[model samples]
Target chain A: MTIPVIAQLDELRSTVAAWRADGQRIALVPTMGALHQGHLDLVRRAGELAERVVVSVFVNPTQFAPTEDFGRYPRDLERDYAALSGTAVSALYAPTAQDMYGPNFSTKISLEGPALGLESITRPHFFAGVALVVTKLFNRCAPDVALFGEKDYQQLKVISRMTKDLDLPVEIIGVPTTREADGLALSSRNVYLSEEERAVAPRLHMALQDLAQVVSRGDPIAAAVAQAREALAAAGFDVDYVEVRDAETLEAVEAHDRPLRVLAAAKLGTTRLIDNIAVPRA
Target chain B: MTIPVIAQLDELRSTVAAWRADGQRIALVPTMGALHQGHLDLVRRAGELAERVVVSVFVNPTQFAPTEDFGRYPRDLERDYAALSGTAVSALYAPTAQDMYGPNFSTKISLEGPALGLESITRPHFFAGVALVVTKLFNRCAPDVALFGEKDYQQLKVISRMTKDLDLPVEIIGVPTTREADGLALSSRNVYLSEEERAVAPRLHMALQDLAQVVSRGDPIAAAVAQAREALAAAGFDVDYVEVRDAETLEAVEAHDRPLRVLAAAKLGTTRLIDNIAVPRA
Candidate 1:
């Protein structure tokens, strides 16, 4: 069945309102266009949770730094629609930049706890932008449940915290990270990688997996993380950060008694790749 | 009729949901619990606009600076309830601080534009706190319209902008400031005034009125504002800021052709007072 596409806010609301009037539960999956199997997986999960599903494809400008890939971030709406066809997604909310952020728009949502370190150090404005856009999406769709890929683990945690803090009525659900057969976490940015960089991209996940095993074996966290960074750098990746921290709080873990996660971000050529894995306790 | 005071979020939501289910529109008037005539005026206006009215009285801690009046801020729930007894308010949402802000709360809503100057210079965290609490109130109540007093003109603008920017599905209505017989804007903080300070408090509003008249007569804005500040200082008050700005944007008005607002904040002995009046443009 051909899925309906909603580009304007009024139309989106009317459609969602009709569904709501019929007592149909609505779920939303927000993404930046270049859709892949991972995004489709999120849509499928949203379908399981709600009777109606909406997917928002917006490459939010605020999340991208001036030097980062705002202009080059992959955008293919026609391909995205084609990819989403026959999926559980009933409508696509593809707002223009102006539609999302009109002139004189100047509000920002900032979060601390889980949004403190990791990606924020390099991209300080990233989560604020994500928070702002996600907030708009939630308000626009008024969804019963919102789905996010756990691939952006920190983002999932940040959105969960934001929803709870703001007392938003929507339930936030995190879907497990979908990965390539080669163990590379699927991301829209993965398309930016050259053939050689693509071959090397899976190493980030592999290094995180190795670090998780070492932490599970009761190795000193600092030493294990440092070793993982060195290995990634040796594999031609410009390592950004490699650390083991509390899975929920994202705070540095001093003891291995609590649930810990091994997280890493590295630049394989021009594309920055991030991945995380849970550490099994001894 | 006596307003039912709801202390729990679940109860508040159930009540609001029941109203919504009956096809009745809801209006919310968010306040801090030292209810004055101005707050009741907001409730009255809220009643005029919707079938049901909810007034949330939460003394949000995040909006207050450590050096500011959080500790000494007045809290008299019984007096507040007594004051609202005969008003049009249907329910009073009085959530405990812990209920509004849980242990892991780490989200903040910030705004630029209208939130840039005036009050923000002294109370930096003020608008963020207001935005956060108001967002929660809107979500919790699911109101069709939310009323705010124009006594805090900048705040009204900030919230209006935030509602637009965040795409919140609620109308923000700014009610005109309710004033004392002597023209002092009614505020909960007025209880902090001593007899001598109370006598001097009306001068803040008087000076703003004078400045508005001066600006209307085609007087240079900077000169008119400077003279108002001098008058406030000579009136035995510690002046914080007295300036003329664009009524909507809160930006300094370069020309008298646009809608102008004369805003002033001054400290009368230990009590802080703020007031604003619309300038008649030439």
Candidate 2:
């Protein structure tokens, strides 16, 4: 059976309101909707956490810069609905851009701290866009809990920080990143990669794993990241950044005294791939 | 019959959750609490709208600049509780500054549209602070409806714009300004006036009223505002602004083509007072 799609705000509210009135717990999984296995797993986890799950499939325009691929971003709603069929998911909230953001809509949620560096350095407008849309989803859906993939580690952290600071009643849970057997972090944009780029993709994760091992055995973080960047460049990728920072705060760390996360982003042709792994205690 | 004061977030949430479980509709009245007749009226109206009413008395530090009156902002909880005693208000959420905004708190909700010009011109940091704190309050209390005094006219419009733009589930209701016989809008800062300054305070309101009258009778908005500014300056107010704007958008208006508002802000001694009135459409 196909899951129901709610397109209007009032309809979505009434639906959630009815479920809430029945004393059912609601969980939300906000997605830009090119549902892959990773997203499916998030839905499964959401079902386990709550009685009903709302999967929001909005391709938020504000998060994408004009030069970015927002225009070509993959959208296949029928395919998505087919993928979610028979799953524990209850509804798909796919509000059109016009419906989601009316003509005069002008509020924005911005953050500091964890949102300051990393992805922000490349896409300064990205997290603000994510924060705004996620906030709107949270308010509209009124979920008891919301789930996100840790594949976009910084995005997860940013959302977590904003939710807590705003005192939003919902709990934000980050599910572990799902990856291909060869270890490429699953991403919607992966479809954009050519066969040659796809063949070279798994090296991004491999380099991080190798870097994590050396750092775990007490290699200096800076030098380890430098090596990772060089290795990715040698593998025919354009490296954006390779840096180790405090895992929790995402603040700059010169040494590995505390729990740390080594994050890296690189481009294989036009597709940017970002991945991070915890540095084992040295 | 002293009303209960809930200072901790956990306490506030549990109380609200219990009320929701009972299927009781909730309303909120957010105040900085030197509870004047204006705030009491908001609480009274909130009770008329919803079954249970929560009055949040947070003197949010972020809304005040260092040069402003944050330190001197009147806070008397016992008196506030005493004032709420006979009203329909159920609880006072007067969380401490530390509890409301922790050491690492770093998220803000800012806006354009209605939040531009007007109060934002003199108190540039003010509305951003108001937006953040109110968003936090709305999420924490999880109200079905929230009430504000129209005395802070620009603030009422700004909050209305934000609540709609962000898709916050709570309905924002504006209560008419509680006023003195001479038309001075009641505010917590009204107590800051000395005997002589008190005599000059109502001129701010009278000036807006006069401006509104002329603009409704076909005077050009610019000429009327300029005359109001001169009248206010002559009456011992170091004038901040006297302008006519679109009532809904708070955007500048030159002609009487739409619903108009006459707004003015001026300082009598150290007390900054602001007031507005409709332009009584031609």
**Using DockQ as the measure, which candidate wins?**
1
The fraction of correct interface contacts reproduced by each prediction comes to 0.95, 0.86
Q: Per-residue CA lDDT of candidate 2, range B187-220, in tens?
A: 8999999999999888889898889999999877
Query: Considering summed lDDT, which 10 consecutive residues are worst modelled in model 2 chain B?
Result: B97-106
lDDT, candidate 1, at B227: 92
After superposition, which runs of candidate 2 have C-alpha atoms over 4 Å from their true positions?
Answer: none
lDDT tens readout by residue for model 1, B10-80: 99999998888899999999998888888988998988999998888889998999988999888998888
Which candidate's TM-score is highest?
A: 2
* lDDT (10s digit) by residue, model 2, range A168-240: 8889999989999999999999999999999999999999999988887878777888899999999999999
Off by over 4 Å in 1: none
**C-alpha TM-score for every candidate:** 0.97, 0.98
**Ten residues in a row with the worst lDDT in model 1 chain A?**
A262-271
Question: Individual DockQ of the candidates?
Answer: 0.91, 0.87
